[model samples]
Target: MANTVSAKKMTRKIAKRTAVNRSRRSRMRTFIRKVEEAIASGNPNEAVAALRAAEPEIMRAAQKGIVHKNTASRKVSRLAQRVKALVA
Candidate 1:
């Protein structure tokens, strides 16, 4: 459908970027899921550790524009609160 050479090149670039973004999104989700699983299991220590690992990944995704900063902050904040409550 892309007749122009430039259009073809752009299509190729889009495909590559889409693959990368998809992987990044999937990776971010996996980290978040780990934290949720830990929390659900009701193990404070494991949840803390998972949150530690997930926070950076969530922030990174936000930085990359995969997710909004507020969303990432909210997620981190809520998870941290739960982890803290577990400790108390």
Candidate 2:
């Protein structure tokens, strides 16, 4: 129940922002899932390619505050290590 005009406007803005953030987060997850699927398939080259595609998106999500920086870094680190282990 937004009582004031300003509060109603703020609610509308929040709804719009929420939709945008949700889409961004979903896109990021899709990228991460692609990497995971590639890894699970045991194709190192495919995994590498997926990781290459996903890294920037993950970082972008972090930059946009969708995820924490360390969370992003840790995910990238772990995924990279898995890809490396697959390669080696």
Candidate 3:
């Protein structure tokens, strides 16, 4: 449907970028899920460690433009709070 050469190139590029972003987002979710699982199991030490590990991955996804900065910050804040509660 793209008659222009540039448009065709852009479509191809977008498809590639979409695949990459999808994978990045999926990986980020996996990290978050690990932390959540640790928290749900109620092990403060493991939860804390999982949160620490997940934090950077989430931030990195934001930095790479795969996710919004506020979204990443909110997730980290909530996870940290939950971990802290587990400690208390």
Candidate 4:
């Protein structure tokens, strides 16, 4: 449906970007899930490690525009809190 050459190129670029964003989002979710699973398993050490690993991935996703900044911050904060509680 894109008659103009520019439009066709734009469509291609959008498709590429969408795939990259989807991959990034999926990877981020996987890291978050790892942290949640560790937490649920009640292993303070493993939860701490997973949270440490997930924090940077979440922040990177936010930096890359795949996720909102506040959402990333909130997730990191809550995960850290939960990890701390596990240690207590």
Candidate number achieving the greatest lDDT relative to the actual structure: 2
Predictions in order: lDDT: 0.92, 0.97, 0.95, 0.96
Tell me model 4's lDDT, rounded to 2 decimals: 0.96
- TM-score winner, 1 or 2: 2
**Tens-digit lDDT string for candidate 3 (1-88):** 8999999999999999999999999999999999999989999999999998999999999999998999999999999999999989
Deviation from truth (RMSD, Å), model 1: 0.9
- In model 4, the Cα lDDT at residue 72 comes to 93
User: Using alpha carbons, what is the TM-score of model 3?
Assistant: 0.94
Instruction: Mark the regions of model 2 whose C-alpha exceeds 4 Å error after superposition.
Output: none
For residue 65, what is the lDDT in candidate 3? 100
Best-fitting candidate, scored by TM-score: 2
TM-score against native, each model: 0.93, 0.98, 0.94, 0.96
Per-residue lDDT for 7-33 in model 1, tens only?
Answer: 999999999999998998999999989
